[model samples]
Target: MTSVVTAGGVSVTMRGPVVDEAEAVLDRLVTDGVPASLMAKNAQLWGPEAVEEASRRLGWLDLPETSRPLLPELAALVERVRADGLDRVVLAGMGGSSLAPEVITRTAGAELTVLDTTDPQQVASVVADRLERTVVVVSSKSGGTIETDSHRRVFEQAFRDAGITGEDLARRFVVVTDPGSPLEKTAREAGYTVVLADPDVGGRYSALTAFGLVPSALAGVDVARLLDEAAALVPALHQPYDNPGLALGAALGASALGGRDKLVIADHGSGITGFGDWAEQLIAESTGKEGKGILPVVVEGPDAPGFAEAEDVRRVLLGARPEDSGLGVSGPLGAQFLLWEYATAVAGRVLGINPFDQPNVQESKDNTAALLRGAAEGEAPTVVAGEPALVVGAVEVHAPAELLRGATDLTGVLEAVVAAIPEHGYLAVMAYLDRFADAGAERLRPLLAQATERLRKTPAAVTFGWGPRFLHSTGQYHKGGPRNGVFLQITGESAQDVPVPGKPYTLRSLQLAQAFGDLRALRSRGRPAVRLHLRDRAAGVEQLLSALA
Candidate 1:
């Protein structure tokens, strides 16, 4: 039987054998006062003081209550932007720094574009037309994120190209970062407006703070109302079974423990589609470490194209009501943000893991840095030419026979890879092609469906995302989380390439480097991963679809 819980205009429908256990866990959490303790800064429940030191960064727990008071200041900033006629915003960030703002802009109709990807074409596509009126928001918690820094550098040059320099350029820029961080120092020196984020809040949890709200305010969203609605969930945090956050978190942890580890979040007309991206980073980074984690698969709808079908998947439906229009958008989204944050913390407790730390996410970053520094010394990706296609890396060849054996074409390689996933494992289909290649990516859905049917024998999950983008988002969870993933990296030759302003490499080169770097990082960790490169986007997707058929 399916169980449904509705709160604050948001509904969570959970179905699985672990539903009861999740409820029990929620009850225990309430009885133990876990949520309240966390809010009270009780770090002992998480783990040793050292192991869970990050847990003390719980200022986000009070953001809704605390940030409500800042609405006037935020509104003033927004008014200034409007008065200055700044019509567009280009947010330069990565992961936690970017996802929440992206959601706010999407749901609130903010005239803002998030530049979280380092792909040159993506960067060009964003700033090409709006360079004159766009205000660049350089957001980063550490202030030294490689991708954010790269984006800032590129856009700074773009601003200069548009003849906006010195005080003018500073007027067109804002910096959201912690006090004394490199970005704050740089922004102060450059005369950019600096919004200091609460140092006690981690990046993934900073949604209610300036990292998320400033952009929301700039986008014309009602920050005061959003905070007020978000604050409503505060009282429920102390409750046990009736609390939405505790219930949802227990379900997530219990489901994973029961073998349904894939959390497929289905957003059905919720106006919060971008919430999935934010939730993905929150859940993945917080709990995906210490060789255990829950996989979050955010889909548009249950019927979304290329949606994963597997027994290990537990669907979480985010449904919207007809009355939920305009400012009402904040109600559901704000509640969800708080719900998931609380639930992730509870789930971490259930899993006996520290919810605040991300230990494995740095491996890929380190590897990418090594590759960029030319310090990555290893064998190049092995290549094999076949009919109308070429296989790069040993991903498919190294896959289980059930997944790849008896294959007659390039599609068979994908078939085999999907078939190789264990009952408790998952398939991460990462595409490094253009974001516009949605139709091409959709062609592989039938294959995923077929793989899902096969997965019933053992049960697994499938996830798909565009590259470099996912690198900043799910990339952390994939590398740092549990070792239950079988990775399939897809790449195609770019039709055209754009170069970074002062970098030696083109966007295409950088994309490939990131791909290769991630592959090396995965293999270095002894995880199963493979790669397939197509000659060009069109022909590659077409051939692969044909081969699958």
Candidate 2:
């Protein structure tokens, strides 16, 4: 067993089976000097096609020191935005671009409104809230993500319609993307401030880069301190047994190797608000491919679903202070970012999978693009695969006739889905509704997990991922990692449609298109996935909860 902490206060401990598993992995890593090789940016770390991608994606390793030059400029830009009375910061990005900043701002006790969803009402609420005092940060590593592009377009029109035209309108937005991206060229042409991030860093590994820093800095976080904290941990990473990154990596990799692939992470008053969400993206997108990956389940706490004793599940506790139990972690958010990034990369070595590439994430996006193209070209876009099997209350339950055969109520319909999970399988509850308005949908995760455990006689992992958002994160795991997952998708018809300015499809169309696209992709792989369309958002939530109860 080992407990390690960097000078920056980020610590990792190896507990129980994790401690023994990590010992074996660390022994090999130390003998091979793998940490040193990684620090030297060796692309051959993960063999095969992964070698090519890893070669181009190691820039995140040096972001702590390399990104220092951006601070003064960020300070000036944030000051100017405040000077212009734009205290409200709205981040328009998806996956890594959105998750990183949301975690950073929240941990720093700063407010950054994240617009990662395509839900019409969610976008409308932000648009309607103090537009004069709002400055949108449009972040997209590819510079052409549909969600970010939609957000950018909507806000650009909003700024102009609010009578803030000309240079002021351009100034109302901050563009963060890679150099030479379409967004960079457009920002320059429009006179908007643009911060080009390191093209070498993969989006999920870019927390220390502009994608995470810009929004955090804009929201009044001390950006320099984050860099400093990460810097302090760099030295500790090189040592063998004393390495925190290696310890964590070994635990994650060894656990998965031991059939404990579901990584259930919970915050026990960690004061690190939403760290689990950020980690979920990094863990899932990085490793959840090649049919051999770790499934990161972000639960509410120790009591959340999937936290119970199970052979396939390894529980991690993020607390107010780092624990030596190895199943827990605590530290500064900056150090936590680097620690996990390094550990994930090392875990890739242990699992023999590329941590840098997200091969499956693109499938859903391609599906969505094809669907949206149909609607833009005048075809009636079908949001769901087919009509629902039953309409119970305000919710329409969509599944195969056999699954709902002899099922009359919502509870019986849900029981069919829960009963479908394999002995070690998981149920992913994905809701494509307003995260704020339909927040009650979160209870479904634990409820479903409990129901599965009670009925199936086997403990099952049930995860809740916001729609389209999960399309980038665990969506990879669903389509690529394991075929044992049973999906329950919840979508709603927006009360009003929000347009993406020059785009052909409205936000509602895009949202449903995304939900339907992913569902089709999952079904194409023969995965058991069910959709529950909420015709009336609020009433549907209440009715669904009642059904679950």
Candidate 3:
């Protein structure tokens, strides 16, 4: 069964049994106005002054109120950039800081390039030509994000190399961070423009805050109109039954409880193309905890092949315009951000967890820091190489027997693993290769889908994530949340290396360390994981595709 509902300019079409399960909860929430009460100033949702006092951190609930007065400031910054003739904006941040800006720039067609990866190749690509005309926005809520700091240092030198120095160098940079964060002081000391983010807001929920707005403004998006559209949905969310947020929340939570834990997003048009990555972080980090989670599987589009037989998946089709027989709407991109935030909060309540806190996110960070420290102390971490390579059509590939039992090649291994996954389980391809490489982990999607359909006689969701980057996003959930994932970690040798600014190691070394560190962390958590070492990225991709085909 399918149904479509439109509210606040956005239309959602619900499909599958999850919709039926969600309606009962939606009815209760609407009648009680639970989600709306959470939005009230200083209101308590979790309990009396206990978690309630902590819920003050829920400033994202009232972002419109906080952001309304900052409109003039945002507009003035946009005008200043245009008047100064800056041609590009480079945002350097991680996770929440980077995802929103990246989506905004891509969707709005703004001249902004996000530098989120620590890959030297990725970093070099950003400053290859536009150092002089680019305004670098260094964003980090904690102001101490190692990646953002490294990026800031790297680009600061790039500006210096380009002959921009001292106070003039400050003109080419802006810092967005919490008011009293270390980055704020550093920016002030260096005379760079500083935009203070709300301290009460968490990074994942800070999309409507200065963290998201500054970059959106720089990207030529009409920030005021975006907020206005988002604000329009607030009243609708308060209504309960007709509330879009409540409906979305109920659907997601109920679906996960019903064994449809995979939330597959299918965008019908380019309007919502980049939104999946942003939503992935929100849903995964928010609801994924205490040995339970809702995995977000973002597909290319509705017509994407291979998932037709997936059973543990729920499909969401995001359309810019309404379909003839289903739901549709026209709303600013900002409205979607607000809608998801509200929906995620509601889902958290449904799942009985704190959506605001990411308790396990720190584990991998600590592991990475330890690895770096060990290297600095002359105690290099052991590099475990996968052995007994399987020969597949002239290419030798390394994969674990658990992932390829009774298999002589990569294709057989994929089939064996797909068959081995328990009912309702998922496959996660954790790739540590460079994002620029076409022969990476994502290529295995279709094969996994095919294997799931053919061998399991059920649909299984497939997920692809780049290493170290996902550490800040879904990594927490993978380790601390559910035991539903069967991981295939992909790694390859770097063709070249670039040294970290002040470290004895290169960026490639850092990446490998992070990958190894995360692998160790997952193993320590008893996660079912296997490593595949490719003969360089391209060959690795080619061999995997050949084997699967």
TM-score of each: 0.88, 0.97, 0.91
Leading candidate by TM-score: 2
lDDT of every predicted structure (CA atoms): 0.71, 0.86, 0.74
Which residue ranges in model 2 land beyond 4 Å of their true spot?
A: 1-7, 320-326
Better of 1 and 2 by TM-score: 2
lDDT of 1 by residue, 1-549 (tens): 556566654455555455575767767777788867866778777778434565557788888888776687777777787778887877888788888988877887766777766555566778786677787888999998877777777778877877888888888888899999998998999888888888888888888899988877877777676677778777877665456676777788887777667787666667665787788888887878777788887665666633444456666656632121100112367777877887888888888888787666677777666555552244222221123223433222333334456665566676677766766777788887666533577546445655556545654566776777677667777887778788988776655666566655555556666777788778777667767776556666776666656
**How are the candidates ranked when ordered by lDDT, highest leading?**
2, 3, 1
Span of ten consecutive residues with least summed lDDT in model 3 = 321-330
What ranges in model 1 sit over 4 Å off? Answer: 1-18, 49-52, 304-311, 320-331, 375-408, 437-447, 454-459, 495-506
Global fold similarity of model 2 (TM-score): 0.97
Query: Which of candidates 1 and 3 is the stronger one according to TM-score?
Result: 3
Clashes of 1: 3
- Count clashes in each candidate, considering only residues at least 3 apart in sequence or on different chains: 3, 1, 4
lDDT of 3 at 304: 67
For model 3, residues 102-202, the per-residue Cα lDDT tens digits are 77777877767877776766677777766777888999999998778888888888788888898778878889999889999999999998989888888
lDDT of 2 by residue, 1-549 (tens): 555444457766555667787788789888888989999999988887788899999998899999999999999998899889999999999998989889888888899899999999999999999898999999999988999999988998888888889988988989999998988988899999999899999999999999999999999999899899899888888777577888888889988988999988989877789999989989988888878889988888786767876889887888633243437777788888999999999999999999988878787888888899999988656634577788988989888877665788898988888888887888899999889988999988878878877788787889899988988788888988977889999988788988888889999889988988898899899998888988898999888788778
